[model samples]
Target: MSVGLVIRLIVLALLVAFLVSPQTFVFVFRPLVRAGQPVIYNQGSLIDLTLNHLAIVGTAMVLATALAVGLAILVTRPFGAEFLALSRSLANIGQTFPPVAVLALAVPVLGFGTAPTLVALFLYGLLPIFENTLTGLTNLPPTVTEAARGMGMTGRQRLMRVELPLALPVILAGIRLSTVIALATATIGSTVAARTLGEVIIAGLLSRNTAFVAQGGIIVGILAVLIYDGLSAIERMLMRRTGQAGRQA
Candidate 1:
């Protein structure tokens, strides 16, 4: 349909083709591999690795979004106002502690595989979404909220019909940021024996096979770009709708 949509589809097609038959691109990467090394990245199925990577990242994002948004909504309420600073500090913990550090600490408790990675990513993604949600909810025009209350709306009704609608654009921006970051960071899951594209990159690094690194990096980069663009489009659409509503009022 649209040019951007067509471009995204082409990228998705290329990614699928590459994952299904990575060796087909051997010529593109042959020069990058060591003299005696095979040009293809054959450690595992790229498709499976990509799917697993997406699943881990998606799970983390869902968890992060739920927690962050809920906490943001909580702190903005009168009953929870006093806990704003505490909530911020808690969200900041993930950013303060590196993913590697989180992973290392979690491995002992979670015992490897996807569990540790999920924890790390969930923590890492919390700050942006939480901060953005807080900003969106807190920054609404007082007049609009007052109007909703004047119309005999309950707190829940005002929040659902008035506050959240206006805040959706800003909240979506946070989600966009979180999702993009998670897509790239999920690669680190491979260190804990989680199947991910990071395995290819790590393998390349260990064996000095540039092809592996390049392919892994390319796929991750493409995925991030695609997701970022898609989320951005959604954010823009929401903003447009919000603007239209404002003008109508």
Candidate 2:
């Protein structure tokens, strides 16, 4: 139990405690509100909202990872090299348009709730994953790749066995970045009637209840920090496995 690990555990415990029995923590938030305003977000369960928020982020991440990583793989290969710029442009298009605008445009076609929110998140999250994967694959040590080639490995074999393994830490780093962005950005999904933690935030904003706002912000912040820390640990493990950690250190 390193100090960092201990701190993370404490944060995790606080989050669970808040979600499991929110009223118990009302005293903590009571100071932020007026006499009659509610301290807790009462319309929906915090656990349900958090789960819905995670579901939306997870789905969008899956879609974005598949397309972004696929395109990254394609453009890195000899046959697909010429299309590198095009792939970059395509990924950039997602980030170029704001999620709000994406949702607004998608609402007419995909309608409201989760569908449009998913579209917004998927597009908004693509660029980081794509760029990171591309950077990881392209910047691998020439000698390591040459050794793989010397071992009579096929292009696909080298990619699957050598390249991808070495590149995974970086790829994971990208996914981590994208996921964190999606987590926070998903809050806006409530504007389109999506079931997310954003609903609590929006309600607080609408009713001018600072306590509700603090509650929503705190939960989302805890989630983002935990997920980021978790992903960073995974990334570091992958780097060590691939010997990148030693080289970097």
RMSD of each: 2.2, 0.7
Worst 10 residues of 2 by lDDT: 26-35
lDDT of each: 0.90, 0.94
Q: RMSD in angstroms, candidate 2?
A: 0.7
lDDT of 2 by residue, 1-249 (tens): 899999999989989989999999988998988889888889899999999999999999999999999999999999999999999998998789999999999999988899999999999889999999999999999999999999999999999999989999999999999999999999999999999999999999999999888888988999999999999999999998888999999
Candidate 2 wrong stretches, greater than 4 Å:
none
What is the C-alpha lDDT profile of model 1 across 70-182, one tens digit per residue? 99999998999999999999999989999999999999999989999999999999999999999999989888999999999998898899998999888888988988898
TM-scores for all candidates?
0.94, 0.98
Q: Which one is best on TM-score?
A: 2
lDDT of 2 at 202: 92
